[model samples]
Target: MSPTFPARRRGKARVGAALGVSATLLAAFGTAGSAQATSATVRHGVFPTVSGAAQIRANAVGQASSDETLSYGGGIDGIGVMSGQPKVYLVFYGSQWGTQTTDANGNLKFSNDAKGGAPVAQMMFKGIGTGSEAWSGTMTQYCDGPLVSTGATSCPSGAAHVPYPTGGVLAGVWYDNSAKSPRAASGHQLGAEALKAAHHFGNTTPASNRYAYYVILSPHNTNPDHYQNAYCAWHDYNGDTTLTGGAVASDVGDFAFSNQPYNMDSGAGCGVNFLNSGSAGTLDGWTITLGHEYSETITDQNPAGGWTNNIAGSPYQGQENADECAWLKGVTGGVGNVTMGNGTYTEQGSWSNDTDQCALTHSTVS
Candidate 1:
């Protein structure tokens, strides 16, 4: 069957919350400090760059006061890890994508690299779950929440904290040749497409996708949700809305999906990493957005049920783990190289309530 558009998220665009930039750290990296996860000294080989531990620790230390102290926005869910490990499946939603090329490491590349293609995202996801990377390990604090509840802060006696994402599988990739282009697609349609991808990959059962998420990458030049005007990209589970998609409110279980826009908006607007500027940074930004959505999905697979703050008057209430620190970088600390297996790509840092700060390098997995 052809892909169908789901209902709009809120009749209009839902803007992502803008975060205040950190001046203290940015000055540390300097102007030329802006670069992808790969190190300046090394060309393309997998060499570990500076973990930025010193900078992150120093930054956290300075914020020791309540004025700077940071804590998890809300309660944590003890299911810490995604059951087994972190697993991801890439779904190229439209046929507009051109030929596919394979890299030396058996990863797939795409002709539409600028439009948030496979090449950019592959490198980002490659080494994420491995090596107890900072981004993944930062989520350890969330494991300390209650066993089951909407707004949990402390874990019940004998309960476990949310485990960090140690390592996992890339799962696989599937380009929906049968599905039509997703130009001007609605949010509901995006959810439907995710369900289709799940079925196509034989991940129909919840067990197969317990800790899995479907990333729907739209072709370049398409506006998934007014990308240039409203928000870069957003993550949410299926059946959350009453849109006219395949999965209705009566759907069996929650299905996590992210509407990744075409890189046309480039790095600045949509979170792509075009070396912090220009159209060329499409892949980098795409990977950044992917990591953001991926992090949120693992922590809050079903949105608020996972780990979200709902306290009144709290600035972060209703925000997920990644949402709290979205687009906010630590300059010398935010962006860094993560050597998963063989690839390293510069991705953004997530909120670490444990340290009450945002860090690019997490020394301990907890």
Candidate 2:
């Protein structure tokens, strides 16, 4: 994601900016008890060694007029819902953005910020990862593959399709407005498109996930500059204030089960270009931003939704940069704060169920 620089003080890395290996936990079976979960699910791992954890004490990331740092400095921390297996959003057949919610105080609520002159509402849908991927549940290491970031479009020849653990259902769909097309209309329009795609799933689920995860793909952002879509502002506080897209690549199609944030303010799929130095086809930035955003949003809808504006301090567990890719190792073994292909600087932070691609001990709130 883009560094909220110029707004940076104290100078630490942005959350999930470094790149490296996944922390391996030793278990009786050689992995955490959650390893090789009994389900037919495939397993994906995350990278964390490339970056170091951040001090994350509110005053670090960005400052305010009153001398306070941004409360929600990006990354998964203090979310309201952090239970069971990790879950995300999937677009619905009849609507978009899923549903919006409120916080503990119930003062801050989710509202629709219009786009293209049309009005709308932003909601939180739930989703999960497919267990039986073509890689046989143990596939990691994605490179510059067209199918990699393309989702169902680039599902290679024999990619398997799996679902989230437990009651995980295809609750909604997400849109994939990559570099262009369906830009301003990303929000609701994207939701509508996803619903259309679900019709193609053809009898996948009758109990749940009966819909497909609709998505759209933009090769290059039509609004690379924040001139048009606020999604371009990514890191700016005002960024979220921009017109919310009614769509995303996730919406162009539908899956048996998909993923999205659990809460309304769930800021998934938006960030500065941090992968391969902002490569066009990398999921690093997408996954990292979406993972952390949804992770925290689902946990604490208000505070978790990046609502507090000053609630910093997300202790990261894994080692990945905002680019959303794995960090294997640098010559030095570990990195603190580093810039990516875009010349933007970011702080390093921990990981959690923020990402469903990997095996996270997904936690939820009461």
Candidate 3:
């Protein structure tokens, strides 16, 4: 069936509470810092570029304090978070990836991956559920259940909370090389690809996809949704109608996915050397970008359906957990390297409601 684009909710033409870029930054980046919601489908969890993050910091320079806390958006589809064990599927979209090979660490590698990002991504997922990693623990603080009221800032006792990927979140990885990925794939096209991936992984029902998410990784040189020009990456669901192509008709249910472009394509604008310097930091942006999306997906699996800032007239009104702390460094809960079972990776902090701060580390919830 052809995908349908419906006008469910009006999407913003630019990034709002997420990027936190002021008017000056918006003009400088020319919409690069925000996602364009040309249609009615709201684009949620948009990750900004380095310049956008800098603008967020600059906007807060003189402020004595700011409220970045998140409140529930009243569950959408009766779902607030990935309350179950989250399963992440990596889909290498397009034939441009060239030949695929396995690295010594058993991670997938591709000859066309100029920056050696494929394996790094695989390893990052593998390491997430291992080694008592506390990064994922930060998200455990948010929850969705009957006991928790809508717009509640903190999860009440017994509220169904987001579970840590105890074993691991990396469920499967596939290379969809059936066709060349569009040079500039639309939001609908990306959603369609994710649906294709769902079918490929045998997740053909809503229950099977309740906690599943697909990361649509574009080829190295291509710019999926013109991300290279505006933002680094963004996360949304198949149900969002504002997608460039349209909202995908998913018989399996509304699935969450992220448009993970080759971050190396945008250099510092996408996080190349934002954390570290020299060869050691080449893939710094890669992990941070993907991690940012992953954190948002599990928490806000259905966009605003989960935990997000819904406070009226606040600077972070619509931002998600990770959006509250994007690109911050050298402070509490800023960007830094995290040790996982697989290896150490650089990642950004996520918003924690319990502590009412951006937490880089938190005690495991369950």
Candidate 4:
């Protein structure tokens, strides 16, 4: 099959929230930071230009409270942090995605329809030539509110980008594998050791169709009714009044995984659900993780790319992540930074078709 997604923005575009940026921190990141998880970095080398982290803060618009704080260490998710035209394997579990199919390589198999009738969680993520890097990263205290809900009711101030997985981190059986079972319970991603093992077993390759599973549970999970509306349940469940263990949907089918860490019954290590430990997971964390690993693939494939852009604006209010100025643009500009609730400002630069890297004239993705 082909990797042709509908490209429609169904879920609300998440607003920037609770992310802090600093020059010192970003400078030490995967790129200029000098760390290569795979040969991709060693091959092209790491980016060596920019330094420090950009500030990102979403302010109080109308619905949210004026007293919420969010901080995120960039690269929260193990996203490879590359820079290239990388393709994320989006394993959707529902009739819409069809049934399980295999490629000639046998490296990546697919079963779009998840077991248990629920909407199969979308498992689209950045990839490395060898394996996957994700996050157990934090989202503590940086959400605007719920975007869509089945029956969620937490008092939130803004619109949420990703909703809680009603199915929990454990997406489905046949088609969609449970991302929660990875060795690194936090990122729910396959670590360096685990990836080599999968390679040894010939279960995967370093080319097309690499899938990274991310969790977006139902409203009940995000502690619906709580202030942050976060998912505080994983093991014993948190004592929030809005807590709903939730039901498993029956619609899932061929997309289930029998593999460890990817399968529940297969003895795979389940996720720790950082929320269970009491934290306000931010949308910024999830988004940044996705973006970081994404850019890495298309660029230098490692920390050797010429990341790091020049500065432009000053911080908005007192918020660190908020009120950032735009500098780098496109592939060369760099890939880091955060934004406020409003996108007037952004952290780190991204590959915007609107303009080239480091272009002063910004254009909307229209």
Model 2 C-alpha lDDT versus the unseen true structure: 0.24
Give the alpha carbon lDDT tens digit for every residue of 270-307 in model 4: 11111122222222223332333333222212111112
Give the runs in model 1 whose Cα sits over 4 Å from its true position: 1-83, 114-116, 144-150, 154-162, 242-252, 272-282, 330-333, 363-366
TM-score list, all predictions: 0.71, 0.29, 0.90, 0.25
lDDT of each: 0.52, 0.24, 0.79, 0.21
* Model 4, C-alpha of 277: deviation from truth (Å): 23
Residue-by-residue lDDT tens digits, candidate 3, 6-47: 222233444443443234333334544333323222334567
TM value for model 2: 0.29
Query: Candidate 1: deviation at residue 316, Å?
Result: 2.9
Residue-level error in angstroms, candidate 4, position 66: 34
TM-score leader: 3
Q: Which stretches of candidate 4 lie over 4 Å from their true place?
A: 1-23, 26-85, 89-190, 193-285, 305-366
Superior by TM-score: candidate 1 or candidate 2: 1
Worst 10 residues of 2 by lDDT: 39-48
Ranking by TM-score: 3, 1, 2, 4
